[model samples]
Target: MSGLREPYGRGADEAGFTLVEMIVALAVFSLLSVLLFHNVKFGVQAWRSGSARADELQRSVVTQELLRRLLGNAYPLIIKQEALQPRIDFEGGSEAVEFLSEAPVVSGGAGRYRFKLFVDRTRQQTDLVMTAAPELASAQDNSASRTLLVSDIDHAELAYFGAPSPGAPGRWNDSWEKQSDVPSLVRLRVSFHASDPRTWPDLVVALRVRADVSCVYDPITARCRGR
Candidate 1:
């Protein structure tokens, strides 16, 4: 009987895990799982944040380029009013700017257009908008189109750089006063709310065409005589 071994059964090494050992193993596995989950979550969040920033940057660049093209193609066109004095079709103010432009924001429509850029404010949001109308629109013509340029703006200011009169000292003015001539330079400054992430660089554009280049100035009428 002593020589004969016990029935074939579990040995000490074959006992399998104890309750405490099993608990410890489970704890270790749970800890590792938690750590891995957090790492994956953090990586995903970072990727999303980076993508959002890149999209915002791209949108800002496109907006700036569009503004540059529109402002750079400003035209010096003169419009004659019925029984009124002829004006150079350029008007600038502190909060708004209107002028004749050779380039239209919307494609396909080709001739000269009257462009107006201004800020629209509401309780929910503030936006910078552009309004375009036909250059030869009659007084009764109410056909005009509006386009939203940028949103969430605090303010938009426009200034003109030129002399009030010919041969006078040039200076920056809040508004363009001379109706017969166009300003030499136009400046646009836009700002956003403190909470907004977007920023705008100041845009200063020089007028390409001179209003009096091929025209004769009539001091008597304070206007350009020839087109």
Candidate 2:
């Protein structure tokens, strides 16, 4: 029985793991752990990046829609200074545009408002901003409220399309020179920094209410009158 290697003791197959076996097992486990951690980290990063891009795209859509509504409702508001000739309350330039529209940016109610859309530049970045006030308020009024439409913008360009004189063919102009008339169309071109991943399409809005229905136009004075 003694020569049979101790029949009651554990055999080689039934013994605990050896030092070399333990070391090899631990090494494999560590490698698998590292690979799993890296895969999880990459997945999280990709999700976050995708979420940010989706948010940016949504913001762009909302901003573009807002601009379209405001510019499409352009109203030909006639402003009469004390004892002066009546003029249309609209100013169009390459970098800025001012006009009266039926849409209200803040109130979201039924009323006419004067809006000034321009680009505000700072040391850090540039933004497209709009100032809104009541239609009766002057441009210098302090009651105007400012809203930021687009952030980190490269530039904003505005173009006007209108005729120079009565019965003349309308053409696109960098700046609107006729203060007594409203442009038939307003073109808004906004660009972001090259590093920005967001993009917006060019917005072209037609003025639905370009002339006052209640007023008669005077061909001689080039003004609207209650004829």
Candidate 3:
């Protein structure tokens, strides 16, 4: 009991930590705090990066679906001219395509409209645009509308395929120049930049109306297997 009392009497002096021990404890606590903060920061950054990539992917998917809808609804022929060979106003090139497309009634437009799809790439940026005008509209109609289908694309290409001539087979071409016929197939490819963090897949559309290839000299009306 006497020894216990002696130790208890010195409690005040032993209650506080020494200066060197305090400094060492503070240094250890600070190091642990720094490590925890850095770990949390890294986790937050990783989550942000993954979320941004997912968003970009979703946007690209929606854009692709819209494009497919337009291409799948491509109109075959607006009118056929008996006076001259039926020359469709539709033209498909390597970088652009112009043609007539059918619009849904639910979308507010009920009839066929002329549409043009083109890529605008400049200043290290890319945009996919669609311009539309009614069939009766002028070449430069003020009522024409434009829609931005996609952006941040690295490059894009358009290819068309159809019978090269009457009684011949179909083949892919960078340009569709058969004035009297429409291409049977259309393909689209888009590539994203390395740093864009977006992905683009190839799109291919088969037209509803296609040209008939097998034909012979017409014995009666002199039309070479027109469809």
Candidate 4:
């Protein structure tokens, strides 16, 4: 009986951890789990933020490219009031402005391309519109064409910089008017929303207009300029 009792006492001593030791182990595990979870959450948030930034950059680049192409290919046109109706005509009675490089083969099928900027009253957004000229018929009668580019703009403004008219002083006009005639330069200002306001381009693009013999205007030597 004494030998058995001695073995039982030794076994009880070695049996298990005390309550305090168990509590300490559990506390350490909880701390480790919390730290690990926080780190993982932070990493996920950072990754999502980075992805959003990349997407915004890509959108900005695309918008800039589209603006550059349209402005680069722009041709000056005179908007006049004929019989109290607005009519658009080329500065020199030349061919209508072409937005796309290729003319569709079908007669009246596709329209001559032109770029315009306007606000969408319904959506309360600014947009760039591309339209085909009606007078210039393509292969088919369905020549009227219109497309919207880059919507959700906060603000967009177009300015004309050049001599107002012959015998008139050179000046800059905030909104294009008929008296402005053929502007030497067209300035485009656009602002859009993004996750990071600082990252937004808030772009300003300047396009040179072709000179007309009647206007005696040279974009290179034009006294008017945009800010």
- Best candidate (score: lDDT): 2
- The TM-scores, one per candidate, come to 0.77, 0.82, 0.79, 0.60
Query: For residues 1-227, what per-residue lDDT tens digits would candidate 2 score against the true structure?
Result: 65666555567556879889999999999999999999999999999999999998898888888888988887786665555666777888998888877756447776678888998999999999998888667657799889898998899899988885678899988987546788888899989888888787889888888676655656665555642
| Model 4 / residue 213 / CA error / Å | 10
What does each candidate score in C-alpha RMSD? 4.3, 4.2, 5.9, 9.5
Q: Order of all candidates by lDDT, from best down to worst?
A: 2, 1, 3, 4
**Candidate 4 weakest ten by summed lDDT:** 92-101
- Estimate candidate 4's alpha-carbon lDDT, on a 0 to 1 scale: 0.51
Task: Record all residue pairs in model 1 with backbone atoms less than 3 Å apart, i.e. clashing.
Answer: none
TM-score ranking of the models: 2, 3, 1, 4
* Candidate 1 deviant stretches above 4 angstroms: 1-8, 12-15, 80-86, 103-109, 138-143, 212-227
lDDT of each: 0.78, 0.82, 0.76, 0.51
Model 2: number of backbone collisions: 0
Off by over 4 Å in 2: 1-15, 79-87, 103-108, 138-140, 215-227
Q: Which pairs of residues have clashing backbones in candidate 2?
A: none
